[model samples]
Target: MFGKTFAGSPRRQRFLGNRREVQPRLEAAKMMDRLTLLPAELLDPKYGVMSSPLLPTLASKFSNLLVDPWESQAALSVLLAYYGLSCVSTIGLRQEPTFGNEKLITTPIAFDFSHNDHRMAQYLMWGHVLKAVDALVDLLQQLDYLGDPALGKMWDRSLIYVATDFGRDKTRPAKAESWGTGHSLNNGTLIVSPLLKGNRVFGGIEPTTCETYGFDGSTGDSTPGLNCSEGHIYSAIAQALDIEFPERIDMSALLA
Candidate 1:
């Protein structure tokens, strides 16, 4: 949900979990409370305060700490769930191993590239996207995350997959940019993963009509009349993640 509003702007992501205020403080303490094993009924899914199930137990204990409430059952459920986590973690639960410690975090990034396709003609659409990618790569390099064995970094373990709803229409003659275009099925996904054969395009764009052509899944060769779907890419990802299915496209050629 966090991203820079403009191209090349100095803004950054918001990480207000540790703030003294209510929301941030509670948000920061959520995981810790669970780790410490708080004894609250609301933490259980059957009696959760804000969920289809009781996702947190300590809600009953802390709800009274806050005054704002539209219903009698509100404060007790919320505060206990929020405050209990913080108190437990700070009291001596959030700790790292003596010699071995590792963490794996994942998040998704979204772009405003829906019907606002008019920005494509102005170069603004790709501008911010490219800049954001550049910044991410820079950070990865600084942290030695891009396959740096000498520094003991994870090395190619991280993957960045850029998805699109669909492609824009090819109505505009080959190279002529247009104001807007309808969605088309001729689109491709951009993936940055060590588990794939990098720097390769499984499909090619036809220059005459500016259309995309799929490739041969077996040989990874461009096939003009061929067609592929998002499911094919999903199969490739599954291969990389060591997942299995009874039926899937033969996309082994894309994997590393």
Candidate 2:
């Protein structure tokens, strides 16, 4: 089994490939037309790294270089991926191109959990959990930035999330001087903001006994065998994304 589930912060629902392939070419052409608009140095540093103007210069110097702008961008993708920068294309979500170039942007979903160990104890030590939440908030902020009159629209709709395989205890296990205190099904929290109607805590927690109870957190408050679980939190996320499934009440909107 997958242990447990919780509200996911900065959840990912996109990826990269062909959509990115066609983007840089159109984007490159756009850059060529705006030659007199502004100097390359004036461009944002991140975007400045790629200079369409130098394609001819580099081509003459290194004949092995691929001349197609998109192909060159693909090479850049390989380089970025090698450095742990994740790349994803929104093409799959939109199904049709509405923007000028249909370009792809890169982003990462970071959590407090350790990549080597999925244990809650290790996760608590990693401060990036809250940092990851901040990153998610920044992502929404960027979306709003593009919506400003100056930058224009970024994405029509964006739904962000924070989730985990299982719920974690607010109390640390080391502080409790106990083992296997992780994977708590009792109660976990999720934070959803601006993208949704409201940002409030959701889900409920059933009382849980210590590890002596065969690692079960059930206080006998619910149906047989169901104990405290993350299913309810995941259900709320699905609903926020407008995802519907025929099942029991996973999350009953305790907060308006």
Candidate 3:
């Protein structure tokens, strides 16, 4: 729904003003409030701020915030994604069987981190991650999770996943802050939902070598010598959400 998210914002007299050195910063301010396919009212930060205890007054606060280009677009996508579901679920409840059943069930509000180097990765972590956090927080609150008679209990059906490619080389020198680190096998993924088996880790990571290990798919036992592939994770989440798959699956280690 956004245009050219990866492209750098160009300079203009109205956006750039006199601070040529801060071209990107000033230009981002102009584009921050740009319109999208989502309704203009839904993008308003004040949606539930006054009535909801979980919401912070953020309407004017986002006006001049110069976020990463991709994140800037993803931030709005987050709202659209959540609200898209909210609209469908609301209308679906009132519609006859096939009338409102044609819409997408949901789509992840996805974004990429430019991990060219440690510094760039850190920038995205600070910029992109925080934006997503805020957007999600707003989503949970704006709909008044289980507070509205119409939308209550929606929380159990929702999930927020924070996934990464892999961890950085744990062996990187402590002083080598600027040195880009290589990918290490060990990493963590965060999934939030009441639907998931809470407070459980499916696999283990070796401390000394930073190597990751697998677990029994049938039973949630850690097997340090064995390794889990990405497929195991896929099966785990798919099973947790009751999503359909064609193959045999028994990764009960990740389900509730």
Candidate 4:
């Protein structure tokens, strides 16, 4: 581990002259609750850029770090998997740590654009989301977690859902260099999982007005004429996982 106990603290310097910190304090805080628990090798981009003699050592140390209880164990578990290490302990459990059987793990990525400055930096925000998801997909593929090979299945039940607070306004400045958008009623969620009925979008977007329309979940047909609620989205996810809920939703179109 990086040898710190709290978040937001500077990582231990790796080299004498390389004063440039490897990880940003803010970004590190967002990823791990305890910055000190991170392995020093990860802080140096060079470790991952090229084969190093220290990879085994770094991986071993990282595996040890996962043994301790932490707030961001779910994220750490993914990180460990990225490094081809096993996360034996329960994620986010502090006391009486034991092997976990949890099939679902959730982590927060700070993609909110509440500040005005973020309005002009949409690309950066999107880039972060893309990079994070790409890394996860790559790791999952490497681990062969996409499907059960024994069953001849193409996909596993694992899923990643990216939900946002709200949607941006349809309107934009006609000729402004830096335009800002406002919060709107419309928004969409991104669901990534091989178990899903892929390559299909349930909602319809109006070209002239840039508005989103509802869809029929049962038939995967555009239902612009009907209105849907947030509960419908929740129901779709539940249906995909084969979990029973009291809420009624026609998620037949959204599930596999």
Candidate 5:
């Protein structure tokens, strides 16, 4: 694991708005300790030297050639399983198409020449999502080949969540060629795992206004008056992991 540390002064000033009144909560601090930092170099298949001795050295043999953009995720998954690690996080895997001597062409669904164009952005967003799923499936296939029952079981219990900053405006520009829109409060989250209790939506969106409404966490029933918050989302994750907390969360309806 990477042993990187950050100074409080810089992080607090830049990220926390230098707010002296705000302090870290005990629960948050404990959660931070559970995080394991993986080396960024592992993303490049060529640099296979792992810092953890518990990991197998054969990881160095994997090729990092950019035949596919999502190959990095598959490589990371192999190393994670070899080391018996539970979770991994990735960033910046989604990028716009590049054109040059070495071409990495990602065909856009629609071309638009505008500073705030949404067509190209939406195409790239879904493209990356699909590629990420493909990579996960590839990793699962490799784990099955290992013939290790325990590793296969761990894969069965694994979950993947993809979160974005915010939702885009429900309406697009009236123009035909180039289009853009502002951000909106209505957004949806994706949870991919076999451990979920049921395949049903816990919230609803108003057709006329394109606004989101909360739902009953205990019954999975619509709760138009109650809005979902960040705390509720975190509570759901804690419940999924079987972590006990004093907070009264209606996770009975959220998880199995």
Candidate 6:
């Protein structure tokens, strides 16, 4: 949840020759417009801005001011560009007919489960998370949740999940530009979401993946890799949203 996200202006350089203070002052003024623009009664600033009656209060009113209107109509262009690079492929899974009406209201999103190359040239950790968020947000908005209050209410119940294989390397990768940034089975998984249930982190990552536990039961084949994280995360999300997982699964052990 970012307050105000601004992409740089393309024509900003043309104004570079102007007073150095002009640009910063203008930007600040625009931001102020956005902040004071919210249609709500302002609470005492002491109580905090969020306490105000602003609709969609969590979203920034200034978000619209981002991006150069001449170059692009999109907000957060720079952040989105950074996001575009780290992402490899986005595979959206339509609700399978096999699930029938059981999945009538739910959508499944599965990303590339392949291990991220630690040696890659550029990788933005937050970018990966944002991509997933963008996808989920797109799915929700497409379903018309943004327009329908009831639909949006139901979406408030939905959960967003982030499942990764082990933890980031404590040392950073060993090769040239690699940095010792490899995998670390040392810490636990990080699960972040605005959904209430997603607030808690889970599991324990030991030196051996074998010791890291995710599921509730002893599924003999459960291995502490990306598979395990995905399974548990899915199960928790399914439980949260009152959706059922597909039966006869390869990842059932992880969901146990």
lDDT of each structure?
Answer: 0.49, 0.37, 0.51, 0.53, 0.55, 0.37
TM-score of 5: 0.59
lDDT of 3 by residue, 35-110 (tens): 2323344456664222212113233223222323333343344434343423211110111111113532112222
Q: Which is the winner by lDDT between candidate 2 and candidate 5?
A: 5
- Mark the regions of model 1 whose C-alpha exceeds 4 Å error after superposition: 1-122, 137-152, 172-180
Kindly give the stretch of ten consecutive residues in candidate 1 with the minimal lDDT sum: 87-96
The positional error of residue 74 in candidate 5, measured at the CA in angstroms, is: 4.8
Best by TM-score: 5
By the TM-score metric, which is better: model 1 or model 3? 3
Q: What C-alpha lDDT, on a 0 to 100 scale, does residue 249 get in candidate 5? A: 82
Query: Who is ahead in TM-score, 1 or 5?
Result: 5
Ten consecutive residues with minimal summed lDDT in candidate 4? 103-112
Q: Per-residue lDDT of 1-256 in model 6, one digit per residue for the tens?
A: 1212322554554455355767676565443333332344554556334321222422342222222121111122222222222212222223221123333221122122244342331143344335445544443333323235565532343343444445554542336664434555544554333454333334444563334544332343434453344445555545444566564223222231
- Model 2 residue 99 CA deviation in Å: 39
* lDDT of candidate 1 over 130-242, digit per residue (tens): 44344334333334322244654322444456566667677665676654567788888887777789888888888877888888777899988777777788787777667
lDDT of 1 at 7: 36
- Ranking of models by TM-score: 5, 4, 3, 1, 2, 6
TM-score winner between candidates 2 and 6? 2
Candidate 6 colliding pairs: 172-179, 172-180, 172-181, 173-179, 173-180, 173-181
Question: Under the 3 Å rule for N, CA and C atoms, how many clashes does model 2 have?
Answer: 10
Separate clash counts for every candidate: 16, 10, 1, 5, 0, 6
Clashing pairs in 3: 146-152
TM value for model 4: 0.53
> What TM-score does candidate 6 get on C-alpha atoms?
0.32
Worst 10 residues of 3 by lDDT: 90-99
Whole-model alpha-carbon lDDT for candidate 6: 0.37
Which lDDT tens digits does candidate 4 get at residues 112-186? 434534533355456544555555454455444322355332125456676666787886577877666778868
